[model samples]
Target: FADLKRDRHDDETINTVFRSVHSIKGGAGAFGHERLQHFSHHYETLLDLIRNGTLPLSEPLIDLIVAAFDTLADHVI
Candidate 1:
């Protein structure tokens, strides 16, 4: 994850990160963690923006979403 952050100029890395967030959102919703669901949904929306090229996948954006994943995991557990 850290390596990806350092080299986010690579399209593949960004897409891989987006897919990971998407999977977490699905699992979080499946486990019925409303907070995780909410957070992941919001986080996914942000990723969608990047995936669609509507928004640039900047370092701060990546960092924020990565942190959101931790929060989602905490809520799930």
Candidate 2:
């Protein structure tokens, strides 16, 4: 998340973030944590858009991603 905050437009960071969230989503699904899996699915979708150049990186989008990370972290804990 810190890396994303620092470089929201960086492809490498975006891919890393996507993979992290994807892993979380997969684990959540495997563990039958439906809510976490759902949230991460949507979050991953957004990252996918960014990665595919369908969505432009903006301050608001970055903020949203950061906030989602917080939510996901809370779920993990």
Model 1 Cα RMSD, Å?
Answer: 2.2
Measured over all alpha carbons after superposition, the RMSD of each candidate to the real structure, in angstroms, is: 2.2, 1.5
Q: 5-49, model 1: which lDDT tens digit per residue?
A: 676356666678678777877887788867766777888788778
RMSD, candidate 2, Å: 1.5
* TM-scores, all models, native as reference: 0.71, 0.90
lDDT of 1: 0.74
lDDT per residue, candidate 2, 1-77, as tens digits? Answer: 67667773468888988999999999999999999999999999999999999998887899998898889989897
Off by over 4 Å in 1: none
